[model samples]
Structures are given as structure tokens and as C-alpha cells.
Target: MAKEYEFTQIIKDHEGVIFKITTIYTNNHEDQKDLYQEIVYQLWKSFDNFRGDSKISTWMYRVGLNTAITRLKKEKRKGNQIGIDQVIMKQTDQYDTEFEERLKILYAHIHGLNELEKGLMLLLLEGKKYEEIASITGLSPSNVGTRISRIKQKLKTQIVKK
Candidate 1:
């Protein structure tokens, strides 16, 4: 396949990763959509620079996360926001009210995390090993392990406080 075709195919295969990164950065649906578009745009611009040193998915996560964190900071600086009414919520399958509420609250806490922790936790939740997380984030594996432990403790404390 051509480079373009290969990139497009790989992106299609892992489309969920784009949204997963975006959602960690923004709860606002409009912000999420904007961030998603920007991540795709960044990915396209840098695709040629990707030399397959890591897995394509790894490359995607690195680019997607860097784009999201940059975009998030830009949005925060601009203080521009859409009205809640203008925000579009994606439909999800209905779960029992209690389960739904808990899921929502869990996501809320995840969203409250700082930029680095958000990426770390999201990667961990995706079942990335500490070494993989370290590779993506450029931290040492031991450092990644320590941070994940700390993050877990913090999240548990936060949950207890709620």
C-alpha cells in the first residue's frame, strides 16, 4: 500500500485511541471534537516523520497526546467555550442508573487529573505495561511504576473523600 493508504488504514484500525486521548483532556463535547480534529491534523502533518521505531499505535498515542495537551493549554488560555446547549453528547447504551452514575463520576475524576497523570492513567487503563507507558511518556519504567502507584493512591483517596 501507498504511504497515505497505510496511514489511513492504521488510523481507521485504531480510531478509538484518538477519542480516548481527547476525552481525557476535555469533558466538553465541543472541546473534544475540536481536539480530535487537531490531533488528526497533527498526525497527518507528522506522518512522514514517523520512522516506525515504535509500533504505529505507540506513535499515534504520542502524537495524539502531545496534540491534546497543547490544544488543552491553548483553550485554557483563550477561555473560549461553547454553551452547554450547543454541546452534543454522543449516545451510549443505557446501563442501570447506579452503574451509569458511577461511570460518570469515575470519568469526572479522571478528567480532574493533571496532564501527565491523565495520560499515564489513560494508558494504564488501556492495559499498556509500565514499560510501554514509559516509552510513550519518555519516563523510566521505574518512574512510571512509582507514578502509577502514587496516582492510584491519590485516586483512591479522592474516591473515599467523595
Candidate 2:
């Protein structure tokens, strides 16, 4: 359908969201790449049901995050050891190698967070509305607001230390 084509185009234009979500959920490079592919595949599968009820990006966050969560669950069950270099980092322009290393350290800390905190921060960084984050993450609006506030303070402290 034309809608599906447009949706694919939109995803291609804004690929960073997928990358960010993958980075947020995965501990290592291989898992990141797998999660990124799973997000893309889920998005494509869900395209026909989009219905334009929400912003495409909001819908995408929902699908991608859900897919990542499910994949994490599956990995836990299978005892999989996702390799670091399995990720194809061949296209990281502008972000230098040092920045990537620092980002990996940051991501490692982020991966230590509980699932709710991780989801909250990921959507917050993606600029989703509080209501939208609640819709996707199943938190009350006020709870989402409080959590985001705390997360910001925590991130500030961490950044100050570094």
C-alpha cells in the first residue's frame, strides 16, 4: 500500500531512532545490531495496522521497544552470548571512535537500569510526549513525569562526575 511505502520512507529518513533504541536496550554490539534489525522488521510488519492514530514515530517506539523487550526475554531463556563486534559499525560518521567507546561505557551503565527506567529514558531522549510515553510504557502520566525528572537528575549527576 502507499501508506506502507510512505512509512518505510519515513523510517529510512529517521533511522537514528532505531539505532538509539537498540543502543539503549542492548549490552553489546551484536545484541544491538540484532535488536536494530528486529525493530526494523517489527516496524515493517506493523506498518499495515498503523491507522494513523498516533504519530508514526510514537507508534514506532511502541513497536520497536516491545520487540526489543521480547527479544531480551528470549535471550535470557536461551543463554545467548551476543558478541561485541557482531555489530556492523562501519557507518559511524561524525561520531569518533573515542566517542563510541565513551558511549559504550554510558550504555553499559544504562543497561544496568531496570526495564522501566530504561524505557523511560529511551523515550525521553527520543522526545516523546509524557502522555505518549505513558501510552507506550504503561505508566501513569504523573508517574512518567516523576520518573523522567528523577532520571534527568541522575543523568546530570553522572555527567558531572565524568
Clashes of each: 0, 0
Question: Model 1, 32-130: lDDT tens per residue?
Answer: 767867787899899999988889989999999988877634444344544422323343555777887887887988987888999999999999998
Task: Residues 1-162, candidate 2: write the lDDT tens digits.
Answer: 787689769887768778788878876665676777778878888887888898877788888888888874445433443452434455366488988797778776687677778999888766878998998888899999999888878877777877
Task: Report lDDT per candidate.
Answer: 0.82, 0.77
Q: How well does candidate 1 score on lDDT at residue 64?
A: 93
- The TM-scores, one per candidate, come to 0.84, 0.74
Worst 10 residues of 2 by lDDT: 77-86
